[model samples]
Target chain A: MENREELKQLIARIKGGNTDQFGVIIERYQKLVAHVVFKMVTTEADREDVCQEVFVKVYQKLDSFRFQSKLSTWIATIAYNTSLNYLEKKRVPLLDDVAPQESPLERIAAEDNTPDETAEYKDLSALLIEEIDRLPVQYGTILALYHLEDMSYKEISQITRIPDGTVKSHIFRARKLLKDRLLAKYKQEDLCR
Target chain B: MSIKHLSDKRIQEYLDNKLRPESLSPDERKHLDSCQLCQGTMADYSHLYSGLAQEERQLLSPHFTARTMAIIRALEKPATAISRSSLFIAFVAVVTICGVVNYFINIKDILYAVEAFSLERLLSGSAFVSTMEQWSSRLGGNLNILVFAGLLLILVGLIDKLLVRQKANRAYFMSV
Candidate 1:
């Protein structure tokens, strides 16, 4: 956040009729934007479109972004909402309760892991990435923002608009679910040592 | 202490390092240290914690910034375009005002028609005053201009509504 002043200056320049300067904002935050967008939007083609749309919205609405939070968090909010809107329109399953949705562990348990695909994974990190992908959009997104993006619960709250407690709860539940599945597949005694 | 075990929630806070050391009572800390269950659970959580923080990030397409900038270029336009809601409000206002003006000219007829116990006169007095004879009766038979202007506005409003809805539908389908 030390770059806060510099980002403010850049945004002021963009708003002061130097519209081409918007590219710098795009360049700086596109990865963070992608981190939010990719988790919600599952389809590649639509994911690209949603990411582009998030920036378009940020550029159009940048004037209204009062320096209340970090610019990255504001851009992240836009990305998160835009991705959710895309999912709703496309009817992708997210945080739904049609049934007790299958966790990665459940699927793994159903499989005969004697020939496990995760055998190709050299470590838990790789297998964790694979499991994260199977998570619901909100679960995957919150985890990515918290863990990979290193955002605190409050920052994630500002972006995702979920309460900070709910953000932590999501992280807790997501980790617990993944851990439960991990324990089921790789028993605690075998791996937790 | 009445409680002999740390709840999963407490264990999570400890794993996240969010719990202050002072906040953890000596009993809880002792219990956690002496408890094999909590230790094993914490180790499993720590592994997940490290994996999540260390997970390889998915990279955006190399040209993602350039593509986004292109979208920004495509979307850039002067801010002078009126919004659809404003146009809708203007349409409703125009209709309301025209109905009011046309009725303002017919307050007497409405009163008389009400007194005479016949609502037909009132019904034909203003709202249905679209014909030439009705126009002559409504506008005092001198300046047909006001009546014609009101009619013209109503016509324009209807056409505007139709075209706007058509444009909106087309845009909706194209977007989908």
Candidate 2:
């Protein structure tokens, strides 16, 4: 609460045209912004670029902020919208509609002969990352927020502007799809053996 | 007991710990404990959970924070600078336009006085003709040149004003 008050004061200063105060806000929320952006964009390079764009937008629109939500929520919202705009500009297709069943896990498992080995686990982790990359933007986003960032469902709902139930459903479906893919990979590896 | 009857979704919920342990009916726990297939499925899910837990906390390179901050700073500097320049340019444009319009409106009164003086009739007709001819030969050419030059100056000023405006517009919208 004390921090929130300080943030509001800083935001007031920023909106009043002290742009250096805006830098303080950026310094504070940079990690949260980067994490959100990283989940949406594919490459490290793009994520870095997008994170900057998000902050730039936040800085430009500082005066318009009505203080209806938390500063972090506002920043995350900007991060989310900026990433979407970046994706749209890049002509990248949305991830939700296509239900590609083929899992990257299958490919990784096929390449490895050893089961339950650390190398196999590492390969599985890599496969998970690839599969996450392939997930629809919405699914990928929720998974990242929930699993990677350890955000609560309520927080995710706030960030996503989706209902909590909807967030849960998407997460459930995403996990099921991921599991099916991994299990199928394991079976295929067995057949090869 | 057909383990096949258990829904993938229900098993997932159990594995995720989303289901309240207190809310689970006795039959559900019994099935989970007794059924090898269900137990095996739970084990697989636990393994997957552990794997995800281990993998999710990936940190970027050590320089990632510095690099991201740098890019953000770069993007922000240009954006704010551009917006500030545009606001300044817009302020100048409004002032200039107001000044030009004021000048034209004030000059219109003087032009009206000149036209009214030119419309007066001659007092002596023959004398007037001679006078008119003299005026036309000497002052008329000079007047023509002066008026033409004045109009040209006004036109050039307006055009220059417009060009400045266009440059500001281009800089504001195009460069960034």
Candidate 3:
């Protein structure tokens, strides 16, 4: 509550044309912006640039903010849009619509060996990261923001511009997808043992 | 007795802690206790959860805020330039508006010129020649009514170009 008040006051100062105060706002929201940008923009070179671009948009559009949501949520929206636009300009299609080329189901389907028999052991985190990245973009983004960024479903919904129910559904589905992927790669008997 | 397994969603809810021991019916609890498949599924979820629990948080570069502030300062530079450009556009707009007003204010003279051009006079080559001569002499060869209209069109075009450029500048500023 007090923190929100401080940010509101600082935003008021920035909007009042005290451009110097923008630094504090950027510092406060930079992580949130980075998380959103990193999730959406696949180009490593473009991520930081898009993150900076989001803040530039925020500074310009600050006066129009209606206080409908938290300032972080608002910044996340800009970050999400800017990163998306960057991808669009690069002629990259929105990844949410396409099943990733190498989904867990596909990988398991392609393997000649049974799931339990030939477990070429890899680091669990490495496999998880690979599988997570291979999920649909929406799932990857919602999961990253939920688990990696530690955002609430409501916050994720606000940032992603999805309904609250959709946010919950995506988080649930994303987790299930990851677990299913794990289940495909290893046997239940092996895991239980 | 054949045991029916819980659906994956229900099992996940249990693993998510949305289900507690007290919440389940005794039959369900008892079944889970002996069910190897359920326990294995639970263990798989536990491993997945453990991996997720250790998902690394991405950190921005230490200078991220500074870089952003720098870009903001760069953006402000163009905004002030746009304001100056807008003032220039406004001045041209005023001039164009004054040209329109001045033209309207001389509507009476224009109407008289039109009134003088009867069909008979237009049909008569001699009358047409004389009338053309008279108007050209009156308005001067350097600036005829036709030339004046042409110049007004050019000025309006200039204003349109300025407006388009201003709109584009504003768009870029917003995009940045």
Candidate 4:
């Protein structure tokens, strides 16, 4: 979290034509940008491209930024929107549209992996992440912004442009869904460990 | 006595720390303390929360910053050039305005004045003086018109400059 004065000074320098100063801004916020991009963009190559494009957009549009929101939130909003645009271009479904035929646990358990292969990567954390990835795009994004980035509901609302209540509902539902699937798949002892 | 289980909302609020156990109402608190089912739910949520918080971030290439900067620097040059051109346009607009005003105010008089200083007119002092007097009178009578024309030209030039810069900005954004 940059203090207001520091942010102002940095922006002033960038606006003053110090191009190198923008590198510092990118470094500071790239991780936050990556979290949003990674959650929204699935492909490694496209994620990297979209992440760079987000920064490019940010740099071009920085002059118009009036500090109405935190810089990180503003950058994250760009990342989210850019990823959506990419998804749209590729004709990818932005939301998970297909209803589940079976429980998430059953779906994972039913994968064609052999018993030994499944046993090899059965970490609870990995399973939870897989479940999260299977969630609806908005749900997964809200979860990443909320839990991973430690963003507040209001900030996530700003990024996703959803109502704060909707953000809360999605997060709760997503977490509950993750928990239910994990509990169904693993014993309490294994999860705790 | 019938026992009521905690609502999912209450359990979530507890795990989210929106309502800590210490802050729970007496009944909810007593139930949470004695109810194995509620305790297990809370534990599951706690583990989920821990896993979420500890989830690893995907690292960008180590050269991500340098590559992004290189692209920015490349794009920035044209932007800087465009802005410089805009400044030049503004300067030309100002100069055009001043030239128009000067042309309206003095070009004819100066031309006549130069003609008056020719050898033929120089030999006749009274004709040169009369021409100078006529030029001053003409300027005084058309002062309002001169000001109005100058202001109109300035407004036109300003609008033109603004439109050009707007187009340039749009182009810059599109290129990005």
lDDT tens digits, residue span A1-193, model 1? 4297898899899999887899888778877888888888888767777887888789889889888887878889999989888888998877753134665456665664553454554467766776677677899999989887889999999887889999898888888877776666565224323
- List lDDT for all candidates, in order: 0.73, 0.65, 0.70, 0.78
Q: What tens digits encode model 4's per-residue C-alpha lDDT throughout A1-193?
A: 7698899999999999899999999899988888888887878767777888999899999999999999888899999999899888887786663356688556665665555665655787777778777777777888888888889999999998999998898888888888877776664334334
Which portions of model 1 show Cα errors greater than 4 Å?
Answer: A97-106, A113-118, A188-193, B1-3, B18-20, B77-176
DockQ of prediction 1 = 0.48
Candidate 2 docks with a DockQ of 0.22
Give the winner by DockQ: 1 or 4. 1
Q: lDDT per residue, candidate 2, B83-134, as tens digits? A: 6656666676567655654544356534543443453533233354555555
Docking class of 4: acceptable
lDDT of 3 by residue, B51-147 (tens): 8767655557787776667667666566565577667767865676557546543565455456558676676644666665665565545335555
DockQ-wise, the better of 2 and 4 is 4
Question: Going through the candidates in order, what is the number of backbone clashes in each?
Answer: 0, 1, 0, 0
Ranking of predictions according to DockQ:
1, 4, 3, 2
As a whole number from 0 to 100, the lDDT of residue B107 in candidate 3 is: 61
TM-score of each: 0.67, 0.63, 0.64, 0.70
| Regions of model 2 farther than 4 Å from truth | A1-3, A16-18, A43-45, A96-98, A101-121, A187-193, B1-5, B15-20, B53-176
TM-score of chain B of 1: 0.41
Error of 1 at B36 (Å): 2.6
Q: Which candidate's lDDT is highest?
A: 4
Q: Write model 3 residue lDDT over A1-193, tens digit each, in one string.
A: 2177787898888878898899988876776677667767776767777777788789889988878887777777888778767777877665453434676556665665544444543557867876776666667777767765667888888887899987887777778778877666654325433
CAPRI docking class of candidate 1: acceptable
